[model samples]
Target: MDNLRRRHITSFQNGVLEPIVFDDKRKSMKSILLSSIKLQKTIAPVLSTIRNFYNKYYNTIHPLCFTFLSFLTRFYLISLSDVVMWDESHFGKFASHYLNREFYFDVHPPLGKMIVALAGWLAGYDGSFDFESATRYPEDLNYTFMRIFMASFGVLMVPLAYFTSIELGFSKHSTILVTLMVLFDTAYLCISRFILLDAMLLFFTLLTLFCMTKFHNQSYHPFSANWWKWLIMTGISIGCVSSVKWIGLFTTALVGLYTIEDLWNKLGDLSIPKIDYLKHWMARIICLIVLPILIYIGCFAIHFAILTHTGPGDEQMSSLFQAGLIGNDFAENPLEVAYGSRITLRNTGFGGGLLHSHVEEYPGGSGQQQVTCYHHEDFNNDWIVLKPREMEIYDNETDVEFVNDGDTIRLLHLATESNLHSHKIPAPLTRAHWEVSCYGNDTFGDEKDSWVIEVVDDVYKRTNHIRSLTTIMRLRHKVLGCYLRAANVGLPDWGFRQVEVTCDKRNNPKDTYTHWNIERHWNSKLPPGGKANYKSKFLREFWNLNVAMYYANNALVSDPDDNDILASKPRQWPILEVGLRLCSWTSDSIKFYLLGNPAVWWSGTASLMLFILTLFWYLVRRQRQYTDFSPGFLMDQFTASCSLKTKNMIFGIHYALIITIFWYFKDIAYGVSSPNIELKDKKWLSTWDIVD
Candidate 1:
């Protein structure tokens, strides 16, 4: 290459790949050392030859060696602590629920817990142990076996980092540094040693990234079998990561970005056949988009199939769905809705809640009793389907009237005796809808309290008469014509933090938010619906369950009154602003703190900032018509790879630095095994809440 072209190429390398074999930083470092330490100049060429030979032969061996060492590092003294730590209290309990085959709900998907349950089963655990925080395990529990099983995932992350880097065209030396950085990460090691989902989450995240890069490298092969294999694997990995936690969607988005770039490049290739381009598009649609969704659904299918008994999470699901649980007796609820029937109305929308009213009044809306959606079982959720106050008032002698389409009725708040009422005031959350509240005594409700029940559909019975737990219906205000809706947004703290309920102004017949189903019927004049009478399709339940998971996750706002000492904002994360206390601080118990190796974390941050600064300089120079990079840094990819010795030294130094830092903090990751430690030594930062 010409002098000018090499300078332009070297300029870009100085910004990005400066640590690679072919940069001037190595020469400068060597010169500084030689002048200060009086090193012989002839040693340079010999050192270069050694690095060249090692790079050519040892690239494959390095990742395997590091992976073996990582396994040792991660699994060493893995069962040092018998007490539960951090999220293990929650997630370990979930794994036990899975082992017991009981249905439960969580804000996250079920795959991680299921995987942990498999490990527990293998360890001969009978799901009888309590995973209370900082509580010691019983002698019979094989918690050691379980911890080692989960730590293997963390160990594999070392080789994954290497393979991911190599697939992305990183140099062999850089790959070694990357592998060591992950291998000795104190935080990663500590998390994997416990019974938590984070280790599984990270393993799948790296797997997703590695699969994406492998697929990218195969872009040249288009529809070859290997290409197809990797594309499908990428989708499967994405599904795995997402199933571990919804945060995996960020990984999916990254893969999506790469797919878009690949397709765009293929689109611009004039020589490739248009049919072949279309094939590429169709393949991506099938493997990347459709395959991931199928995998996600498959996980839920497995989740539903195993958890067959009623659990704490039954209320988070629909009443009909809960009825299918082995222990739930609600399946025997009476089928038909009649006058004087007590029931809970469930909103039919995805992630919907039970129609509820409490004595607390809406501060900004109608000032009547607050009507909201309750996710839990509460007496306030119960309402009576009764005759409008003036029409056919409920009396012992009055003939029973089954509610049907077009029947005008009033829903009496069974706890408070207030009728469900709607008015012209704006809703608390959704401005486009009217406020729905309970008003007037059961004997005095007027036209505003009247609702015309319109049956939408029925699962088993197609009659116009409403049925409990099956008939889907909408409640249209008799006077204002607004449909009752369980708004997805939640009310503020003063309203008890329940989901907002409103009367939607639009006549959107397809709006499921406005749809309601009678649940937990208490009518005595009818026969039991029978468990055999109620059934649930997994697909419908799957979507509804996932939506409920999403809504529950979004509803988790930080409680203002909760002095969450262990939690830190994202801004405090990178610079080691705080470290979490993983277990109890009692003097007799062992302790663990989740803190990353400062050497790796701070350097990565510095590297990222340096890249941003260099890119800005290049852009500003280019706009001034500077010939410094006439043909641009695109040519840097073709620059020669030489001067290997300096890269080898840098890689060695970085690897050693990571390991040394980890050793210094080994007590924190491996647990402070001895009791009664000093507070100053444990607390590395002012923000850390570690106790003596």
Candidate 2:
């Protein structure tokens, strides 16, 4: 048996039995423990490697966290106590109406107000005009919620700006710089504090740019399904931009031009045969032209549906329809009416358009020479160097006397009148240049010398005396001269008016007297003797002058007008409201200028077309020169330096999709929570209303 066992052992050593014996019982257990220890050691390093990989790849902050931070920063930057800048008041009013489901006129589209209303609803603040609550109220909501929403938009802009900058061949540092500049700019901050459409418009504009960049860089076979989806997305983004502002139509034109350039660039070295060229071209055309139009029309359809069914209030709906009808009519006939009355009411016989009249020949005498004096030739050319001419004031105890070398003088005579007393010193003397000076001693020397004098009547039947006469006199000579004289005598209050002047040449009598009104003096060059019917037109054009002067004065006293406020107020039928609001903070002229129908769309379209044509020509020339083309070349050139690591790109795309989906569902949630009858009464709401 031992010999057999030894043989078995020897055989087993070559096979399995000897190994089993060597690892028997306690030895086997020790061996197994060693193996287990080795496995445990290996597991720790492997697990550690895996954990480091995960942390490196997926450690970005949640989007919600960033969103929250953005909101907080916005609220801090825009304090609640901040006064409503010009435009914010209009937006605030609209948002309030939106929250209450009350009607409000809107010249602009409803997207911006809708955003503000959404924020207010999320915060559980009722949009009422109640002034009782210090916090959690509509007024508070107006500033706070709008700030938070806009701040969030501003923050979201950072990544998009970075992406666009990178795509446009900028360095990472440049991207950061652009983002920081946008974030900290006073214009951006001021705009974010109010509910304005610009932030939203900018956001959509950037998004469209990104989509176009993506389409230009992506690698896709002709007619690939994935390529079609990207093209559709590009069209949708551009359409969304246009819906925000009519200026977005320019953006659509840009996309169409890009598509044409892309196709032309692919034409020279097309990998596919000529037979397939037409198909590829058709696909591109569909993406560039047909798809964009469809998307644009789709957005309008949504707008139409919303306005028809679920618009804020009855009055708002009526106004919206009326505005729409008016817009349609204007589109059909774009002619504008000229601003002028049938006949020139104030005809000096030398007339034309108001702007066409010469300054020297203005009905209100030439600005060059005064009635009694002329401008000095030694004055500086600089406007700031010109100062008001100086005049002297004199007091002679009993009477004031004004002396100047000029032929004209303005006499302000202060006299006291009493029912108990009336007295005069020297009057009833008619010389060549004699004119009535009421409440004054109308005395004249034998010579045609100008004089200003006043008589005073005592209050308690006392003797009358000359109180005071203040005169501003200008000497008619080669040089401009001014002098003032004053005398004081105790007197009560009285009123005076400038009387008509009749000049005698002998006393030189030249029919030089003209009609004087509150603001200006009207002069007509008629013969020395004729039926000179001088009627005062009282040109209330002072209103226009005051408006212009107001702007100039404000420029001198404060900063330039707030453009943020001007840009926000809508300008359709609701323009009256915007104008009223602007008048509160700006000159009437500026209000008119902003509200006036300037050619915003036409100018923008022209610029867009020029850019598109230039880009097209450049792209075509490049394609002709370099015929060896590959899809990879375009992709690599367009997106080679973008920091879209595979994992991050995938994650970003997923996150974006989720956010978009969330937006759609959030609208639904808002609808469900709304105080409408469909939700409250358990009635089935049509899909048209829901989608809207």
Candidate 3:
């Protein structure tokens, strides 16, 4: 038994103690074995070191898992119902139209809407209906699906921003901060919820900027395959952005400017023999100018093809030529076309359109009076305060009973009475014993003495032949005045006078009357029945008065005295609508030209010029001095000054510019405006008010 116990102990020490042997051992023997053994020792420090190393490197979850968790968290935390807004409706409608094979004059580019439609189709939602009908799924589900799409983009932007920041040499923290800020911004959040183009624009523009920075930093030749590829990508990206909105021109402009500056800086660095200046110049031209121009043209070609494909009709080609002509015309003459009819006078040597008519014919006519004719208070004479007057009477015609006193009366008569006292007119035109009389009868009263109302002018005026004609001419010059005065005669009214003035034509500037002239003959008659005979005279006289006034006012105002005084007519709504449509069409054309061939043309030419200039300078100057021509002087300074802080600042600027571009152009591309509410609002505590 002791030998057996010894054998068991030996077996345990050797790690060969089988379960059966242990089970078969007696209780006393087991206790003795348990107490007799020292506790098994461990390499605690080595284990601790190993554990520390693992925690440092492998304890954190895998990036893929983290990303998945992030997406899940976003899905759970964000409320899809909170995404309700105008842009979403517009996007849904546009996508539906696209999916239904319906043609539409979409102002925005089709990429973002296409993506949304694709998502909807994959999710078993109909993309060929209006938002309310197409989004028939539960509101939360529909919105969540849309939000998830946008959120995916948002998350993508995080990595893009990081890589771009690194390419720009931004510090790690600044890059992270910019990404975080964008991630949490309420505007960004809300915008992302809808399938809008802004976020996409931001992404593209950032990518472009990054690529451009990389291109600039490279020391390789411009004609290298890699360089060409980068340039092509840059061009395509910029073109896409511009396709979304006209404002993308700003980005294009910036890129062009930077390229030119870079070329200029490199021009002074060329090493060439003075005798072989021409060869070097040719090389520089090909590198800087020709290559860039080719790239720019290639970019523009894509845009041109797209635009031409989408434009309405074959008129686009002719319109383009006309556009060029119009631009030249505008540069030559800056005047805008007159708005309305152009009157041309016949049988006059001065005949022209009314816009160019002589000012003497219709002086001082206000533009406002041409469109709407009405009686306005004569502010020139405060004593002539006259209210609008109307006379009404009942007339029964066959079966129709007409009530003159009712609100439905159609005929209206306007009257004004002028008080003529010896004190009102000049004393030379007034006499002591002259009398004025008026006569009129009511048609409804059988023309009896009781139906007639007689009026006598209490004031009188004595007039010589000259003065009487002068008064007649003045009175006839006012059309409405003459009409009212003619109606007032032979009626029960007061204030009538015949006045005259005496003056020689050469000496009297105010005496416009000529009694013997045929034009003034109609002005000599008395009122009421005489109105018909004076109609032409009244029109002529009033027109002359208006012409005189218009000139005088024009002189005082320092404005043109052309006959187009009344040319400022209200724009017709249809015409305005047509004009807007035309403008949009033309704008699209301009954008296509700018994005496609123009970019290539300009960039290539600029590069060629830069290269040529560099070669020329290199050949002309000997032993380049730092102050005079060294390109490396400024380059070294620039590189040295680009510390971490400066790089961060630059990255910040890049981020800001990219974001701003997105904000401005997104609406144009998406056909929607920003919303007016927060993305998430939690109101847990509130005061309640009850009204009875």
Segments of candidate 2 deviating more than 4 angstroms: 1-75, 96-107, 123-143, 166-171, 220-222, 274-276, 279-281, 288-295, 298-692
Task: Return whichever of 1 and 3 wins on lDDT.
Answer: 1
Ten contiguous residues with the weakest lDDT in model 1: 631-640
TM-score of each: 0.81, 0.37, 0.35
Candidate 1 deviation (Cα RMSD): 14.7
Q: Per-residue lDDT for 1-692 in model 1, tens only?
A: 23322222333554674432354666678889878665456677789998997878786668768888988988888888877777877887888899999888899988888989998999998988769877788898888988888888898888899888888777655666677778888888888888888888999999999988888788788789889999999999998998889999999999889888878987898999999989988998998889988888889999999999999888777778888999988887887788888999999886678999989898876688999998877999999888876775656644567888789988999999999999999998898889999998877768899999998877775987888887889999999999999866878998788899999989999998999998888877777888887887788789889888877887787887899876578877788788888887677678788888888888777766766666777789989986453321221222224456755665677778988988888888887756645645756677776663
lDDT per residue as tens, model 3, 58-97: 4133233334533543344333233334455676665565
Error of 3 at 573 (Å): 34
lDDT value for model 3: 0.34
* Candidate 1 vs 3: which has more TM-score: 1
Question: What C-alpha lDDT values do all the predictions have?
Answer: 0.83, 0.37, 0.34
Candidate 1 has what TM-score? 0.81
Best by TM-score: 1
Error of 3 at 357 (Å): 28
Misplaced by over 4 Å in model 3 are 1-79, 82-84, 132-146, 220-222, 272-692
Task: Order candidates by lDDT, high to low.
Answer: 1, 2, 3
